[model samples]
Target chain A: MKIHEYQGKQLFRAAGVAVPQGIVAKTPEEAARAFETLGGPIAVVKSQIHAGGRGKGSFKEQPDQRGVVLVRSAEEARQNADRMLGNTLVTIQTGEEGKQVNTLFVEQGLKIVRELYLGIVVDREVGGPVLIMSSEGGMEIEEVAAHSPEKILSEPFDAVAGLYPYQARKLAYALGLDATAVRSAEKFLPQICRFFVNYDCSMVEINPLIITEDGQMLALDAKVTFDDNALFRHKDVVALRDLAEEDPSEVRAADTGLSYVKLNGNIGCLVNGAGLAMSTMDLIKLHGGEPANFLDVGGGANEDQVTEAFRIILADKNVKAVLVNIFGGIMRCDIIVSALLNAYEKVGFNVPLVVRLEGTNVDKAREMLLASGRAIIAASDLTDAAQKVVKALGA
Target chain B: MSILVSKATRVITQGITGNSGLFHSQQCRAYAAECQPGVDVFVGGVTPGKGGTTVDGFPVFNSVIEARKKTGANTSMIFVPPPFCADAILEAADAGMELIVAITEGIPVMDMLRVRRGMEKSSARLIGPNCPGVITPGVAKIGIMPGYIHKPGTIGIISKSGTLTYEAAWQLGRVGLGQSTAVGIGGDPINGTSYIELLKMFQDDPGTEGILVIGEIGGSAEQAAAEYIKSHVTKPVAGFIAGQTAPPGKRMGHAGAIISGGAGTATEKMAALRAAGVVVSDSPGGMGDAMKQAMQR
Candidate 1:
């Protein structure tokens, strides 16, 4: 649900939240053209990736080149874009295996008098959305939260009413803004809160919410993510998703109606529920087997989803064994067994399989699995399933 | 002797014309007949525009007000979709229903937040928007969970996961332990009730002897419940925290099931429960045994 910075800025513009003018470009030439189009003496070429820390990030191929570069000329913009595009960017957030810079944003750099932070998130404990602001903006919020916790200030707001004008003005004043900037913030901050509510945003952070030399408030950098469950209502936000930034296997799993998260282990797990699937993986590790991935075929698994689940697991070369643990409910154990048998035939299981079936019509399911005459190892319970899968892996 | 529901509890079905709604309504009616013959626990159904019609021997009403007025139903089982699910819940609450059990999954958190605010001013108690719903073994079954596995007994259970709730029930049944009442609190960021609220009820109820809590990686509901158990709950308590293998910030199928800001991990929840003198199960496979150990202590 995380949108690119350019996409976020576009949303900001639509919401009447002031943002620095920026053009998203896919090529070095487009970046140059965008720089010229902006007609600014100083332009910032930012690598567009899902992860943060782009300003401090470095390219893997050209380590000397930064992910975010300050360009004084159009030629300098193209040079930085050429070095960044199609190159892997390593940031504090991107980990060792970094993301490729397929897109760049050429923005007009603003002369900031002061930089401050503004964040909005659904605070689970508070049971509503909360607005967070701080004096420390350009730096990582985590560092500010950890070190000088007093510097960061936040307030919980009602979901329907949103952040009150007084609350917005309070934060603006707390950031030590003068009368003009505080008045501007009273309007700007509430607009951002309204934008967050209107768009179903789970999180919206404007790091370095800059104050220009002329005393106008604007979102210098925007990071926004909408609630995935609420995506049905917002088709436009769903279209903003960059599939290239996501793991291909995960993207495929979503399309196939399976919840899959690949992990670094040997035993592949396919279970019915999210909690049970995670618990199954934990049990595998507890029994000396590392799970290759976490896959949930969901509560009502038909033949195709089960087959895709297996095929996805088997597709991983590291997976030494497969564990299928289903605690059947509305979907009977017999029906799941039928799906498993059909999926086994379609997917062609190459690894050792350990199956544990429980709940409604379980006896019939166990009998059917035994009657299948396939090389499926049956376990009596969850722990037994974990032990069998690990034993199958020879761990 | 169940906490919230018994065989005498009257029920109404919301979104009764939908696939899952009609299907589960039929199953629950059948279960009611099987457990207590000719009870007629399911009094009416609610479906807007489908009013003045009879579906499967149940009368459909347009509004919750008419349904409550006609049937005198005390409890509502909702199967409405996510978009209108909040409205359905509020309608039931506004109609003065005692209990509203929402079986609809994928309800937007904002909708639930608004529902929470509205419920604060109303008298109705809500259960789940994205949940399997509650069940009191043999007497009343009010959800999509398979009814045959549960039986009448003493272990009071509350879980965030649906199948894991069934898993614990099945495991407990295997060892000759049956549930007095098992509740699925739902796996959403904001639920109608919390573990602490339910635990307090379980402690006060005589039907529940030993308590089993099944939690996952998400908010600090489990930790809060653990603290409540240390101070208030004298009953033997056992706990299980799922998703120990899950990475931080990854949503594990469940919308609320994620570790963020270096908190709400399985390890932290387990540590909290352990420190509270509750028996925390090492693996999901061992929940039944852990509860037994707690009872013996």
Candidate 2:
């Protein structure tokens, strides 16, 4: 659900929030053309990826090359784009494996008089959305909160009302903005907060929110993420999802109505509920086995979904063992056992498999699995399943 | 002496006549009948516009208020769909139900946030907009947990998941320990009731001796619960935090089960629980054992 900086800016601009003029470029030619079209003395070519800390990120191919660079001309923009596009970017947020940059954003550079941070998140403590502002911009907010808590100012706002204009003005003044910039923030802050609520955004962050030389406030960088559960109401935002930014196994699992997160391990987990699945993974890790992926078939998954889940789990070559943990409540264990048997027949498990079934008709499920005898280990409980999976992997 | 519902608890089902609503309603009634000879704890149902009607031998009312008034139902279980489930919960709250159990899932976080605000003005305590509801072993079966696995006893359990609650409950049963009341707090970021509330209730309930809390990665719920346990709880507490192997920022199936902002990780929650003198179980399978160990100490 994370969108690139350019896409975020597009959302921002569409919402009437001030942002530097920008063009999304997919190639070096497009980036160069965008730079030329802007006719700017200074333009920024930024690699478009979901993760933050892009400015400090470096290209893997050319270690010296930054993912984001200021270019003065079309040729320089093109050269930077050439180095950035189709290259892997490693950032503090992206980890060492990095992400492939398939898109570039060319934006007109501005003379930033002052830099501030603005972030809106669903605060667990507040039980609603809260807007956090800090004068220490362009730095990690968590770090700022840790080192200098006084520098951060936060206010919880009603989701329907958005951030009040007076509150926005207060934050602007606290950020050391001039009278003119504070006036502009009354409009800018509330408008952006409206954009966030309207889009069902889980997070909207603008780091280094700049005051231009002309005293206008603009979002220098926008990092936006929408609530996945709220995507049903906003198809337009769903269309903005970039599959290139996600794991293929995860994307495939989602298409089949499964919640799958790929990890670097050998044991694959298939559980009914989120907490149980996580507990199963933790137990596997506790027993000295790494989970290859976390897959939850959900509460009421049927035979087809189970089969697809198996296909998706086995699709990962790194998966050396498979553990199926289904805590069937209203969904009876006997029915889920039949589904598991059917899925096992279709998927043809190559790795050692352990299945833990609990709840309604559990005895029936155990008998059915034992009768099927398809090279699957039936675990007695969660710990038994974890131990069996770890043992199967020889961990 | 369960914390919430018991054999004497009368229940009303909202969104009854809907597939899941009617089905679980009947199942809950059947469980109560089995637990208490010839008695149905689920008195009636509410399906708005279906008043003065009967569905599957259970009288249907137009509203929760009508059902509560007519059947003397003091608790309400909701199975309404996501969009309207929040309103259904508020309706139950408005009707002055002592306890409202919401079994519906996928209720938008926005709706839950609104529900949280609305509940602040009401006295009715709520549990699970996306949960398995409450079960007091043989006394009452209010929501969706399979009734067969639970047994009546003194260990009070609170969990953020449906099936994980079952896992812990069944594990306790296997170890010859039983639950006084096992409550699913639901696995959403904005749940109606949380660990702290249920933990305090369990701490005060005389029937409940040991406490078991099952939590996953995400939010400060576990941390807050641990802090409460440290400051106030005198009962032995056994705890388990899932998603130890979970990667940062990945939502592990549940919307709330994500490690965000480099906070709300399994390690942090585990440390908090351990520091609070809680016997934190490393394996989900060891929950009952953890409780046994905690009680022994």
Candidate 3:
């Protein structure tokens, strides 16, 4: 549910939070046109990806190019966009494999007198949304929390009553804003808090909440993450999702009603529940085997979804074996067995497959598997299933 | 005596006319009927429109107020859909139910946030919004977990995952360690109850001899529980956390199962629990043996 910086800025603009004028561009020509449209002497071309640390991130193909570049001319903006778009970006957040940047945000650069941080997060321990303000900005909040905890101040607001004016003023004063900037922050900070509550946001961080030389407060950067469950109420926000930034297998798994995360290993795991799937992976590791992926064929999955899951797992060339562990409650075990058998018949499993079925007509599933005689190994329980899968891999 | 539900506990079902509500209600009712020192757990049902009717011989009331007024039901189990679950919880709280077990999953975090705030002022204790509820084995079963897998003994259990709760209970029962009560606190970022809350209850309850916790990667609930156990809890406790191999930042099919800001990883939670003198098992397959080893000391 993490939105790109451009999308987050759009939300910030809609919420009356001041942000620099920006245009999303898909090509170098578009970047040049956006720079001209802004009438900017200085523009920042930021790569649009779901991860953070973009300003410090570097492109894999062009080592000289950064994910976020500051250009003094329109031609430099176009050049930066040309080097960034369709290239892999490796940030602290994006891991070593990195994500591809398909779009760029060409925005007007601001002359800042001071940069501060403002973030709203759902603080579970506090039992409500907490507003975090700090004098330190443009750095990872975690580092600030670890090294200089005293520099940060937090205000917890009641979800029902929401952030009060005094709370915002208190935070503004705590961050040591000047009188004029404090007056502006009094209006700006509450709007951000209100935006967080109104939009069903899990997190909203405006890093480098900048104070201009003229003493006006503006959000220089924004990163917003919405609650996935709350997306049902806001169709507009759901449309902002960039599928290209996500793993294709995970995207396909979501469409197919399965939860799948591909990893580096040999055993492919398909389990019913999230907890059990993770436990299954750990069990595989304990049996001296590594899991290639984590797949949960959620409750009430049919034959086709199971088949789709098999195809997705087999698509991974590193997977040496498949482990199917299901403890059905609402989803009957017999149905899972039928789906597995049907999938095996259609997909023609090349890897050694181990199946463990439990709960709700489990005996019927075991009998069906035995009668099929499809060379699929059946397990007595979770432990047996893990041991059998590892043994099947000849490890 | 169990921590929550026992033979004396009276239960009411919300959204009883719905498919899952009606089905699980019957299963729970049948389970209570066969349990030792048999109890009638399903006292009434609540459906907004279908009041005064009956679903499979259980009386249905229009609202929680009417249901509580008629049946004297003290506990309410909700099986409503995600959209209306927050309202259902509020209704039960307004009706003065002592314990509210929300069996519905996928409730919006905002709704839970508001509900948690409202419950802070109310008297009722909420168990879950997306959980398997609570079960006092050989006494009263109040959730969707398999009744056959549980047995009444000395071990008390609290978990965040539903099936893993069953998996642990089944494994413990296989090793002759029957449970006193097993509770699933649900896998939501903002749930009503926490491991620390239940740990205190288990510490005070005399029937419980040992405790088992089934946690996952998410939140600092386990860390908080570890801190609580260090100074407060005296019982030998064994813990197992799921998602040891799960990649960071992924949701892993549960909303509360993500690692954020380098916190709530399985390794971190396990290290915390181990440092608190709680035996922590690496694999779910070895959880029972770990618990047994802890108890032996």
Candidate 4:
């Protein structure tokens, strides 16, 4: 999962990486207090959201207001925070809908001589982690790679062996760092790499890594995402999750062991697997309907989980119809049918519902649904199910 | 001839006493009993400490070595949990099993990385730690796929998703096209096999005339396979990628389903496949029709 820039910097500090002093503020008063505590000539109030490109992002409610504002005094910091908090921010990374800003990072401003970029990510093709550095730092790395490919350099290393000294020195010289900064990097880069390995991180990006006039190097901005599958090993990292930054339905689905992503559509889709859930969404779109949400009840879901999934799907007011598609293998079709029936009885389906069951006692499932005499549309197959759902919606 | 398994393939179950292991093992045995003309493919099982006992009439051994020794099994399917899955794969690899299919999900990436490093000197081919295993219709069923939906035909299928494999194979069956062999290579960042490997296998199989490749967002595997098909593969192929409407930078319930650093988009994959002369369908429900049209051409 993703954490805010302030949290990432905190972890960076704990890892022996240099970062500007910062304090997290949840309200305008707190931001003012943080600004006073920093005692700076200039401070930055950055809106804390999961997405990147926050500096270029603008508040939707106050179109002229930027998400990140630099102010000279505590009153200005408070004003900026008041303008940003509880406002929706639209960024290039955050789709058109954007995300809400609930917290701010008030950090002391820094003096920089030059900017560089450093990142550590798993190179899937290389089957290990790689360190990517570039002379072009403040700009988007992908854009830099596209336009000026010669500026980017990468070193792939074995995680088990740790980052080698020679690898770090080579990258430091490749980025054309001066003698003092190069010496600093020899000590700094490996620590950052160690942080990546120590935290079970999937990605660590330090954009616009700055070198001060005094030859000190520091990370100006950090974005870290940990491996979700490895979270069981690190409870401290799991505690960093922010529920306010996520969609409520998605958070609830995770708690209930269902996978759900809400979309802006009218057709509610329920499928047994991830790929099938996505394929079902595509089928819904193919039949001239938009999917309201993508819901995978998992392979071993029971009646209670199914009922909760139905409740979560119906929580969206935009849902016009429901489509239940199950290709049960380890999960029996009769059990799915029973769960569907139980969910309908509990939730009281008002919209048109289409059900398609296949594999493992499917005849019994179909017979049970037929005997129920409910106003549910039983489809013959996947395509038929899509067509039936689309037709029922009068789309 | 099938690509991976046939009537002569011998199988053993690891984690045989577990719920999923016993259920799928029994289902596979029942399918073989009803469909196979004369071959008994499932040989024995392996479970730690539960060895010397019998599960569903199959002898349970303490280790893969003992199971192989007792049954002469050359292939094994794993249903172990995530924590011990890598160890299980290493055990099978060291025991010299020819093909190992791991059906367990959520194996840590670091574990798999170590396993891949360990397999450098070993010759065993691993299919998945989070996949539905291989199946050759009417001959041998190795993993969790329902056998009733498949039939023997000229099509070879390889997929990254378990249920989508069944969906695509069922679509092919509905169109009167039977499958020669179907394999789910699993949905992880690093897997044992790639689409290029399986495509080469299908290209060489005399009984297979067409291929159905089900790809998704997340890696360069599809683009790599497209490049391979452009130069090497001669069989007619159809492609379907899930998550066409998926948003950028979101993991759609699959560990390997994210579009990272502006790559691995469905649109890009589809274009690559089409450039390689593979008929690619936009909607998965229409994939069988797309393959049928490609075959007719």
Candidate 5:
């Protein structure tokens, strides 16, 4: 689950981290008032969306050097906010339709001396929470990692024991901080670790954590992703989830308790388990077809879940064909076939459906589908089923 | 001659009082009874407050300690909920259970981290907290895997992804290379065991002639295991990595399966395994044939 930048800043503030004074405004009128509350001559206006790279994409447009007179006034800010709200702003970070701007952050602009990247993530190799600090910030961290991996310092901490004092100091030293900045950075590390563990965050990143000319550290931008499974524990974080930034098919699948992720392909897949879903997609590609999505109906798939799965797969516009691969162990194939037929009758699937059902009750499942006399095609092997889907899609 | 479990291993179900726990526990008991005559594999159980009760004539104790004390059960299968899964794992570990297989998913990484920290001091080995348990075939089946697919044979299997275990086993069975033991270590970002952990076990087991390891894009667990196999293990190993269809930016299966800036990828893992002299298959269909060839070599 991804939280908006403004919400991430709010979480940082709650954790006692110092951020620029800002207020989230929905309307242009609210934007001017928020500017008034900040009492700053030069305020930074930012679009609040789930994705990053807003500045590079022109989503975040600063006032022209000619100095547009109207934007300085309250009425001008109102008109600007109104025009931008509800409109999709395309960024390199935001794929396709860009991100819809529902809210804007009016913050006090600061003079930056240096931009630094600071983040905490669950490092799989270390098997603990790792704090990533770098002198280079604002740019794609991945580029930095590839070009100069040594620029980034990863300090892992045992979550149970919390961040050690020496570890925090070590990161502060690695950041090459001055005396006061070193103390400040040291103060913030443990707090951020606490925020990470308590909030169940998969990643908490502050890009362009700027050092003001006056030598004060300020978080200019924030990106936080929470663990979706841990959402049950934190309702506040769950409430911050913006469904607009996510794929509609995936959201629908989530609603039906299915794990679905959209990809750029033509063949829609409905598999029983996560591992099988991935393998099915891989096999489809190996057989000269692209998988449209990864949809796992989970282990204990029943009639209702399978029907919902079919509905979700059919809803994808890019899906030229459908592939149902069920390596049934705990789940029965006859039940899945009946559910597929039930969903087919209700939704009236227009695309070709190629199914490869194996394991328990496979013979009965094949007989039931064949007995329906429907246009449903069945294959005995995964490769054959993938081939059929690819040929049908003209791939 | 299974790896982790056999007919002599005593089993206990942790969340045996719950709906899923009770149902699967009963299924396991029935399977054990049908597979072997007079085999008291599932001897005791633990469900916190539901102690002093019996489910299907097997004793249910309050704690793992009591279950171990009363029934002498060495192996435990967990069906606890996600939130309490870490505690259940720790309890079995603290009680000195030799093997603990956790079937619960959605466990928080923090909880698992703490549980793992505690487990570092204990002698008990952990299998999974979000996996489909382990099966030793014809001996004592400790997990939720369909007992029918497995047969006592020479192939030892270790997989990070669960469903691929079933696929590998099914394919291996087709080629007459049934498994001695199959373990699903799960694909969560933070898990108890690694591919190397299970590979070491498979390497030591004498009945296992060859190993089939199914990995996916994620952490360097597969690479580490490949290095281990290259240096130490004499037995032949066949490998297949899933996530060839995953997009460059998208996460494929597990949270750990993100290929950020091109670090851990299926192609990279495959290359590493191949360089390590492991037979790496190109497709899931080729897994059985690859294993067969590796065994012959």
Candidate 6:
């Protein structure tokens, strides 16, 4: 689950992280009020979406403007906010839908002394949460990683032992911080770790954690992603989940308790297991067709789950065809076939469905499906099924 | 013969008195009895509250120690609920059970972390806290896997993935290369047993002649195991890492299956395994042929 930049910053601020004073505005009137309230000579108007790279885009800053006159004179900022508010702003960092700008964050702009990247993630190899610090920060962190990987210093913390005092100071040292800044950063690490564990975050990144001319470290931008599975434990964090930012198909699939991820393709896939579903998608790609979505009905998929799965798949507008691949070990094929037929009846799918069912009463499943004669195509092997789906899609 | 479990290995089912626990335990006992005549592989069980009760003629005990003492059951399979799974595994581990298979899924990551922390100090080995469990062909079935498909043979199987194990085993069975012992270590982000641990065990077993490993995206467990196999294991090994083309930054089946910023990909894992002199399968179906070719080599 992802939250907007302003939300992340708000959470960070609540945790005592230094952030520029800001207000989330939904309209030009609210934006004007935010500009006036900040009372700074300059203010940055940023589109508050769950995306980065907004600064490079049309989002602008009005410098040295004062009061209601500044609000009136800040035409470009108002126009940019107006243009982005209801529309999807496509930034380089944003994937697919870019990000829907429902609100804009108006903040006091600062004169930065230095920009740095700071992030914390669960390191797979280290088996603990690790804080990554880089002197070179902001949008080019990816470039820095690709070009000069050694610049990023990783400090792993044992959650049980907590973040060590020495490790925090070391991370601060790695970031080339001054003594005061080191002390402040040292104080910040425990709070960040606390926030990470308390919020069940998968990642918390602050790009361009800038040092102002006044020598205070201010987080200019924040990106946070919470663990979806852990959402059941954190209702407050779950409430922060922005449904508007997610794909409709995903939202609908979540409601049905099915794991669905939309992809750019024509063949809609529904498989029992996640690995099989992924393999089926790979096979579809290998056979010269794109998989429209990754839909796993999970281990126990009854008739209703199957119906809901179909409903979610059919909801994808890009889906030109459908593929139902079941490698039933514990799951019965005859039961899946019945569910497929029932789902087809309820949803009245217009696209072609190419199903490959195996294991546990497969013959009975084939018989039931063949008897239906509902224009559903059946193939024996995964390759053949993928080929058939691709051929049907004319890919 | 199998490595961990065989006809002579006494079994105890932890959480045996619960509905699913009793039902699956009964199924396992019935299957084991049907597999061979006078096969006393399954001996007794444990359920905290229902200690004195008899579950299908097998005496249940209050604790793992009591169960082990009474029945001399060295192997224990857990069917405890998600909340109690970690405790059950810990209890079994603390009891010094030779092998423990936890079929319970959704165990909290924190609990498992602590469980793993304890497991590191213990002598006992754990298979999963969120897996289908393991099956040693014709000897003992300690999982939810349908016992009919398996036949005793030389193909030693290890997998971070569960469903792919079933698919690979089914294909191998079709090609007349049934498993010696197939273990689904599971795809949980924080699991107990790893590919390296299982691979080492499989390498040592005399009954196992060849090995097949089914891996997925996420951790470098497959790569680590491949490196180990290349260095130490003399037997032929085949590998298949799933999610070769999984989209970037998407969580697949397991929490561990996330590919962030293009790291720990299937391609990377496959490349690593291939570079390590392990025969890597192009698809799930190719696993059997890959093993055959590896054996030939």
Per-residue lDDT of B88-204 in model 3, one digit per residue for the tens?
999999999999999898898889998987777899999997888899988888878878888899999999888788788878977889998999999899998899889999999
- lDDT, each prediction: 0.90, 0.89, 0.89, 0.89, 0.82, 0.79
DockQ of each: 0.80, 0.72, 0.65, 0.62, 0.69, 0.50
TM-score to true structure, per model: 0.98, 0.96, 0.96, 0.94, 0.95, 0.91
Prediction 3 global C-alpha lDDT: 0.89
Question: Which number leads on DockQ?
Answer: 1
The TM-score of candidate 4 is 0.94
Q: For residues B1-297, could you state the per-residue lDDT of candidate 2 as single tens digits?
A: 888887669999999989999999989988898889877688889988989999998999998888988999999999998878889999999999999999988877877888888889898989987889999987888998889889999999999888888888888887888989999988888887879889889999999999999998999999999999999999999999988999988889888889877899999999999999999988888898999899889
Best by lDDT: 1
Query: lDDT per residue, candidate 4, A1-395, as tens digits?
Result: 88889989988898899998999999999999999999989999999999889999999999999988899999999999999999999999888889999999999987788899888988778888899989888899989989998888999877777788888889888877788988888888888988887787889999989887877789999999988887888788888899888899999999999989999999999898888898899888888899998898888889989999999999999999999999987788998898889889999998999998888799999999999999999998888999999999994
RMSD of each: 1.4, 2.0, 2.0, 2.3, 2.6, 3.6
Better of 5 and 6 by DockQ: 5
- The complex in candidate 2 yields a DockQ of 0.72
In model 2, what lDDT does residue B58 have?
92
Quick one: how many clashes does candidate 4 have? 0
Q: Write the residue-wise lDDT of candidate 2 on A1-395 in tens digits.
A: 88779888988888899999999899889999999899889999999999888888998998999988999999999989998989999999888999999999999988988888989988877799988999888998999989999999998889877888888987888888888888889999999888978888888999988889888999999999888877888888888889989888889888988999998998888889888888888888888999988888888899999999999889989999999998888899999999999999898989988998878888988999889968889898777888888898974
**DockQ of structure 6:** 0.50
lDDT of 5 by residue, B63-102 (tens): 9999999888998999999888888999999999999999
Candidate 1 TM-score to native: 0.98
Can you give the lDDT of residue B218 in candidate 6? 84
lDDT of 5 by residue, A1-395 (tens): 88888899998998887799988889878988977777766676677877677765543332221111124555556666766666777667677557678888878867777889988888887888998889998867888888998999988887866787688788777778787777777777778788899898888889988877776777888888887768888998888878877888778878888888888898999987777888899899999888989988887887788888878877778988999988888667788888888988988888988888888788999999999988888888777888888888974
DockQ of 3: 0.65
TM-score of candidate 2 chain A against the true chain A: 0.96
Looking at model 5, the pairs that clash are: none
- List the lowest-lDDT window of 10 residues for candidate 5 chain B: B249-258
